[model samples]
Target: MDTADRLIESTRALLWERGYVGTSPKAILERAGAGQGSMYHHFSGKRDLALAAVRRTAQEMRESAEERLSGPGTALERVAAYLLREREVLKGCPVGGLTQDPDLMADPELRAPVDETFAWLRERIAALLSEARQDGALGPVLDPADTAAAVVAVLQGGYVLARAADSAEPFHRAVGGVLDLLGARVTD
Candidate 1:
């Protein structure tokens, strides 16, 4: 990879591991094995580098979700596919998980990608729920926004709970619980 590409990828991993507050320019440069001049030559600063990483990760996630949502299926089927798709659950959703970082949230420009990513995901889930409502799949009484929040919440909260316990079981149960609420049969 080129210098800029190397910087961005290093920033992404550092941000993922150390978060915005915990990460430092030195950490990134050290991780990338790029000198100070090489990094400053590419990015305006740490924020610039982190923004690129965030945007790239967000785009990747959106593309992955879109593929699953667009695949041939009923609305419920698509929703299920999107939810139960295998993930590195312990690592958390790259975009969603970043939203909780204080330093990241403090920088409006840097935070934009995280906010936009979740906003798009919620909208997508709500739209799918709307379709499910229209198709008589989900109950009419179910509120689309509430349902969407519940779906995203399970994933986010599961990550938090799992991280707290340092185990994947909470994430599993949370996702399973949401699926159960959606009236799908839960697998063993």
Candidate 2:
């Protein structure tokens, strides 16, 4: 790859592993096999490079969701499709995992993509929940926004739990529990 592409790819991988603050320029240069001159030629520094990486991650995530969310299905079917999609659970959310990094979250420019990505995902899920509610698949008083946020949190948290526990069982259980909790019931 070209220097610019190499730099972006290197940053994306490193950011996923070490986070923004934890990843140093020295590590990036070595990882990319690019020299100081080569990296600086493409990016101002770590922040500039990280900003690009975060934006790239956000775009990727948005596109992936839109693919499933917009697919043919009932609200439950669509939601389940998105949730049940296989993932490398141990790797976690490339963007959401960065949210836990203090240094990354502290930088407004760096954090914007991370925040926006999650916000967009929450809104998308909320739209699906709204549809479910309208079709009487949900409680009439259900709040789509809160429910959506909870769903997002569960998936994100599931990744964390799975990663920490070093097993995908937690992730599967978490998603299944969420579906069961949100699924319609006949009880009063």
The TM-score leader among the candidates is: 2
Tens digits of per-residue lDDT for model 2, 35-108: 99988888888899989888998999899888889899888779888999878899888778788889888999
Stretches off by above 4 angstroms in model 2 are 185-188
Candidate 1 residues 101-173, lDDT tens each? 8888898998888888888888899998888888777887888888998898788899889888888899989
For model 1, give the 10-residue run with minimal summed lDDT: 179-188
CA lDDT of each prediction against the hidden true structure:
0.86, 0.87
Residue pairs in clash, model 1: none
Candidate 2 whole-model C-alpha lDDT, 0 to 1: 0.87
- The alpha-carbon deviation from the true structure for residue 122 of candidate 1, after best TM-score superposition, in angstroms, is 0.5
State the TM-score for model 2: 0.91
